[model samples]
Target: MAKDKIVLAYSGGLDTSIILKWLKETYDAEIIAFTADIGQKEELDGLEEKALKTGASKVYIDDLRDEFAKDFIFPMFQAATMYEGQYLLGTSIARPLIAKRMVEIARAEGAKYIAHGATGKGNDQVRFELGVAALAPEIEVIAPWRSEQFRSDFPGRAEMIAFAEKHGIPVTASAAKPYSTDRNLLHISFESGMLEDPWFDPSAEENEEMYVLSVSPERAPDQAEYVELTFEQGNCVAINGEAMSPLQVMEKLNELGGKHGIGRVDMVENRFVGMKSRGVYETPGGTILFTAHRKMESLTMDREVMHLRDSLISKYSELVYNGFWFAPERLALQALVTESQKNVSGVVRLKLYKGNVIGAGVKSPVSLYNPDIATMEADPSQAYDQGDATGFIRLNALRLKVSAGVNQSK
Candidate 1:
C-alpha cells in the first residue's frame, strides 16, 4: 500500500519547519517540501538540506525571482499600487506566485494535499488559499496552523519547539529572538513577537541587522545623485538611458535607490482580517519606480484621465492588499489603469539624496504640456481672448452670487 503524498510550502523557518514535522507525524503521509525563491536572499541558503533533514521526503526549490519581478511587482508598480497608501504589498504580492508554484509542483509530484504554515488570523492564508483555488481547486489544502487537532496538540510556539527537540529537528530561532520576518527582493517585513506591543518603539539595536538592501540613512552619501528613468506604456524600460529588461531595470534602480537610503517605511496598516498591525518595510526599487513613473505621467498624462485614475488609486491599493489580485474587479480596474497609461511614455530625471526622491525634470513625445499655452512670456494675442474670462467667471459664480444676494435680502 502506498502512502498519500502532501506538498508543503516550506520556508525553512521555525514555523514552517515545525509544521513540516508535525504534518509528517500527524498524517503519516509522504511529505514533499517546496520553496519559492522570490528573492529572499540568504534565507534560501541550505534550505534543501534543512527541509530534507527535518522530515521532508523530497525538496523542491524553484527560483521565481524573474517571474516575481516581471509579473507581480511590475504590474503592481505600473498601477502605483500601495496597501493603505503605505505598504508596497511586498508579502501580499509574493504570496500568489508562491501559491501558484505550490499548485504546479503538487500536480507534477502527484500530491493530493497542499499544506502551508500561514496562521488563521493572518491575510497570507487567504492569499494562498485564493491562489490555489484560482489555479488548482481540486487539490486539498491542509493548513496545520488552522487545524483544530494541530492547534490542540501544540497549543503554542513553546510546544512546537518541544516537538522539534523530541524529534531532533534543528531549530535556529528561539524565544529570545521571536520576531517573525518575511523577506523578498522587493522588501523585508517585520511583525509579530515583540512587535505586538502598540506603544513599543522598535528597538533600534535589535533592528540594526534587519536591513538587507542598503546601509543606514545616516551613513548614506552626503551628495545627491541624479538618474534618468525611461518608460513605455507604463513599464520602466531603462535607467540612466541604458536599456534593460524588466528585471534588470528593477535591479539597477535597487542599486541606485539603496545607495541613497530610499524607500524605508514604518506604518500601522489595517490588515484584511480587520486587525491593525505595525510593519516596517524597505522598498528601494519600488520607491524609485513610483517617483519616476509619477513624474513621467505628469508630463504625458491628460489632466482628466490622471485625476480619474488618481481617484481610483485608493480602491486599487485596497484590492491588492486584501488579496483580490486574481479577482475580476481588480482585473477590470487594471485594464483601466493600463489604458490610462497608453500615452504615459517618457523619461523622468530624479534626484536621490538621503532617503528623498525629488523630481528633477521630465520629457515626453506625447506630453500634454505646451510652453506656448503655459509660459507667461508667450504672446497673449495668439491665445483665447481675456474678455471671455469675465463671462466665464460670472457664469461659474452665478449660484454663489445668488446666495449672497439672497442672504443680503434676508
Candidate 2:
C-alpha cells in the first residue's frame, strides 16, 4: 500500500525545515513542499534547493505577488483597514492567501493533509487554520507547533537549530541575529526575539541590517519628492500619468517611497489571540497607496457617506486582523465599501518626506466641494447661508441649556 501524503506550507526557513523532517519521521509519509512567492525578495533565495535537499518529495515555488497585491492588498486598502489604528495589517493579510493556495495545491496533488509551522500562541495559527476551514474544510491541518509532541520535543529556537543540525538541514540564523521577519510586496515585518521588550529600540545597525524595502528616516534626503496618483471607483489606476497594472504600480511606488524613507511604523499591537506584541514594519508602497486613496476620497466622496464609511473602518479592520478575509460578514462589509466608492475617482498629489505621506493637492471631476460656498472672500446673498448657523447652534445646544437651567433651579 502507498504511504500517506502530506502537503506542507514550506518556507525553507528553519521552522518549516524542522517540521518537514519531523513529519516524515512521525508519519512515515510522502511530503510535498509548497512555497508561495509574494515578493519576499532575498528570502526566497535558494529556497527550492534547500527544500529538496532537506527531504521534500516534491517542491513548488509559485509566484503569487500580483494576486496578493490586486486581490488582497487593494481591497483592504480600499476599506482603509488598520489594526489598532496603527499596524497596516501586512502580516495578518498575507496568511489567508498563503493558506488558500496551499489548499488548492493539496486538492490538485490528491493530498488530504495540510500542515503549517505556526505556533499555538500566535494569530497566524488561527489565521491559517481558519482559512483552511473556510476554503477546503475536508483537508486536515497539522499544526506541529501547537501539538504537545512537537513542543515537548523542541521548545525553542535553540532546540529547533539542534534538530536541524542532527538532521543535516542547513540554517543560517543564530543567537547573534535573533529576530523573526516576514516579507511581501506590501511590507516587511519584524517581530519576536529581542523585539519582545516593550521599551527596546532597535539599534541603527540592526535597522540597516534588517531593512530591505526602505531606509532609515534620519538618513533620507533633505528635499521632499512628490508623486501623483490616479484612482477610479476606489482603486488606484495610475501613477504620475503612467497607467500601469496593479503589481507594476506597487513596484514603482515602493521604489519612490523607499527612497524617501516613507511608511515605517513601530508599535505594540493587540493580537487577535488577546496578547500585545511589538512589531516594526516598512510598508513603503502601501503607505503611499493608503494616503493617496484617502486623499482622493476627500475630493470625490460625499461628506456624510465618507463619515459613515469611516465609522465602519475599525470593525472592518478588526475582521481582517482576526483572519476573516474569507468570512461572510467581511464580504458584506466589502460590498458596502465598494458601494461607497462608486464616484471616488480622482488624482491626488502627495509629498513624501522622511516617513511622512502628506497630501499636497487633490482634484476630481465629481468633487462635491463648491468653491463659491467655501471661499474666504465675500459671498453673494443667494450663496450666503450664514444666518442658518444661529438656529443650528440653538437646536444643538437646547439640551445643554435645559440641563444648565435645571442645575441652577436645584
Which one wins on lDDT?
2
Off by over 4 Å in 1: 203-206, 384-386, 402-410
Tens-digit lDDT track for model 2 on 300-397?
88889889999999999988788888999999999999999999998999999987899899999899888878887777535767899899999999
TM-score, cand. 1 vs. native:
0.93
CA-RMSD of model 1: 2.2
Among these predictions, the greatest TM-score belongs to: 2
Q: Rate the local accuracy (lDDT) of all candidates.
A: 0.85, 0.88
User: When superposed on Cα atoms, how far off is each prediction in RMSD?
Assistant: 2.2, 1.5
Model 1 residue 35 CA deviation (Å) reads 1.1
What is the TM-score (0 to 1) of candidate 2? 0.96
What's the TM-score of every candidate structure? Answer: 0.93, 0.96
Clash counts for all predictions: 0, 0
- The sequence of per-residue lDDT tens digits that candidate 1 reaches over residues 1-410 is 89999999998887899998888899999999999988887889899999989889999999888999888888888787777777888889898889889998989989999999999888898889888888898999998888899889878778877777787777666687667788887887777776777675653655656567766677789999999999999989988888998878877888888899898887888878888788777888888998888888888888998899889888888777777788889889889998999988989999999989999999999988878767778555567656788999999999999999999999
User: How many clashing pairs does model 1 include?
Assistant: 0
